[model samples]
Target: MTLPRMKLTDPKALRGYAHPLRMALLGLLRQQGPMTATRAAEQLGESVASCSFHLRQLAKYGLAERAPGADARERPWRATARATSWDDDSDDPQVRAATDELNAAQLALYTRQAEEFLARRIDEPTEWRAVTGFSDQSLYVTAEELAELTGRIDALLAEYDDRITDPSRRPDGFRRVSLIQLAVLSASPGGGPAPAASANPVEATPAAEPDAAR
Candidate 1:
């Protein structure tokens, strides 16, 4: 099945999703699959009541829904979409605030995942150990080029998206890997947005000194 993606443009929806626990629950459903609140709570080390409430809240905002086989007493929930997206260019103050809240929650979760991986990395198989670690790099490119780069990256990641919602697709000895990708535009020396590369790129900026290269 194709990955479902919801682009949230409503401020009300953004506000509804501002809660950290709700974010976590939604992420769990998206990354895993249909799960009862009790089971999700157990996995998250949270109360079943809390998980149930949050799952309902997510449903209210169209972020999640009842699974096909779910019933009143044995209800199982699943994310309505594989991913939720919001544009940073929103003009509404409420939406901006809600976006900030969501971003902070996402960053916290990312940090936790990174720390957890590091803590247990030593015990992982040698093949995994050799491939896992933080990889940071920067490049100078035009805005259009950066957009293309991100699109290409998304296409590459889409190849593995099926594994998340389909356990059967998971290969032997393979585990879920969290790939946090960020394409941020670096600021110029003056601390503002960097200018696009000029036609004469060489003349746009002075060549770095040998000592400054490092």
Candidate 2:
């Protein structure tokens, strides 16, 4: 099934969701399906109370909701959407500022994850090591072309969306992979002198979702 997506426009909701732990919790729910606060805390190494509180806050902002539980006393929460997005081009200053904060938090999360992978990369099996790690590239394209390129990438990743919710769909040796795509304008028209080249440069890959915060 195509996972539902949540688009945030309200400044209050954007600010509330711009927290590190909250983003982590939302990502956990999306990856593991519905889970109780205690279970989520165990996976994330956070205290049960802290996870519970943040889960409630996520629901308040419409990013998450209560799912059917094992019994009356059990409360399981699930992400309302597989992807969360926002308008980076909002005219409202409050919305823009809130999005900026959220973007910073998201970048921090990605950086930490990348660092963790690098710290243990040497120990990974040869095949895994060969396939893992990052690459980058500099592209020259029009704004419309960039949009088209990102859209195509999103479509390609959507082919595997079902595997996220169905464990049976994943084949043996399959594991989670994080793909971060960045395509920012490096320089403006007739700007400054060209920067020095790096000794080693990498290729670029587009991300799975457009305007997705998580």
RMSD from true fold, candidate 2: 3.7
TM-score to true structure, per model: 0.78, 0.85
Q: Give one digit per residue, the lDDT tens place, for model 1 in 167-195.
A: 88989987555566656655563345444
Query: Which parts of model 1 have CA positions greater than 4 angstroms off?
Result: 1-3, 68-72, 165-168, 187-214
lDDT per residue as tens, model 2, 1-214: 5578888899889989888788888888887788999998998789999999999999999888999999999999988887988878888899999999988887876776677677777887876676766765566678899899999988998898777777799999875677777665666764455555544333222222122364
Question: lDDT for every model?
Answer: 0.69, 0.77
Worst 10 residues of 2 by lDDT: 202-211
Error of 1 at 114 (Å): 1.1
Which RMSD values do the candidates have, in order?
Answer: 10.7, 3.7
Number of backbone collisions per candidate: 0, 2
Candidate 1 weakest ten by summed lDDT: 205-214
